[model samples]
Target: MEKNEKYLRAERKVRALKGFYIHLIVFILVNIGLFFIDLIFSHDGMWFYYPLFGWGIGLIAHGISVLGFGRLFDEDWEKKKIEEFMNKD
Candidate 1:
């Protein structure tokens, strides 16, 4: 029973880590796409600055969603960490 629980916990951790990586990749892709779009539309220079500014804002929002917020709770990764620590004794 204990071994099965441990395996399940590890599986959950892997899934959560995978989710984090996916979000990171999405963030990078969105930024890159926006940069290219800005480069193309900014032929007039300052006009494209707004999009770049918006991109910065979007980045911040994404960071908050992925890192600052309680996304860790959704993954239950911290709970597993605590359990492992408690079992160390």
Candidate 2:
């Protein structure tokens, strides 16, 4: 049972990491296309930065969640919080 749980957790982490990678790939490809489109059609103004920066923020957040920042809120933290609240009651 314990080993199975560990496997499940590891699988979930891998899945999250894979999702982040896919998101990154799409962001890069789409932005590259968008940049060229803007350059060809809208030469008078540079507007690619808008979607680039906006989607960039989301991509950053996703990367952080799958990479390191998410560790701060894992099962241990949840259990500790639950224990703390239980003790209060």
Candidate 3:
């Protein structure tokens, strides 16, 4: 039982770490893309700034998806698991 619990915890931690790294990579890529788009297009006044604004919006959406939605689901799952473990003990 203890070994199984340890294994489950390890697996969850590994998955969370993998997701964190993936999000980091995606965030970096989006920012880089925004920079290039701004550099190439915004030749006039602040037209390119539009894309930056869009990027900001995208970041907020991503944050809600990742931190809010993801964490909410994870917390529910963790809570259920904890309840089950406690019941078993």
Candidate 4:
């Protein structure tokens, strides 16, 4: 990869990781706020878990895309394997 291309790829990855972190922070903050509101207003039934579990699934997906199994096919890994195979000649 060319120098600029490498920098661009790294920049994109950093941006994606940063976005995921921000998403997580927002999820936590919003869920905490909703839980409190539910506790004060309802107090009869726990309803926050609906959005909690729903959004939690999305958060998990985002985490997977950012820091989870998606790494198995990342560009750096692919290039390393390609180089390893080529060097066996």
What is the TM-score of each predicted model, taking all chains together? Answer: 0.50, 0.93, 0.51, 0.79
What would the per-residue lDDT of candidate 4 be over residues 2-89, giving only the tens digit for each residue?
Answer: 9999899989989999999999999999999999999999968999999999999999999998898878888889999999999997
Ranking by lDDT: 2, 4, 3, 1
The whole-model C-alpha lDDT of candidate 3 against the native structure comes to 0.70
TM-score for candidate 4: 0.79
In the range 1-89, model 3's lDDT, one tens digit per residue, is: 49998899678867766776676687668777876776787776545456556766866666665556756666558889899999999
Query: Model 2: residues >4 Å from true position, as ranges?
Result: none
Q: Write the per-residue lDDT of candidate 2 for residues 1-89, one digit (tens) a residue.
A: 49999999999999999999999999999999999999999958999999999999999999988897889998879999999999999
| Number of colliding residue pairs in each model | 0, 0, 0, 0
lDDT of 2 at 30: 99
Model 3 weakest 10-residue run by lDDT? 44-53
Error (Å) of candidate 4 at residue 9 is 0.5
TM-score result, candidate 2: 0.93
lDDT of each: 0.68, 0.95, 0.70, 0.94
For model 4, state the Cα shift of residue 88 in Å.
Answer: 21
Expressed as tens digits, the lDDT of each residue in 1-89 for candidate 1 is 59998899678766756776776687667767766887787676644456556766866665665557746555467778889999996
List candidate 4 stretches off by more than 4 Å.
73-89
Give, for candidate 4, the lowest lDDT window spanning 10 residues: 67-76
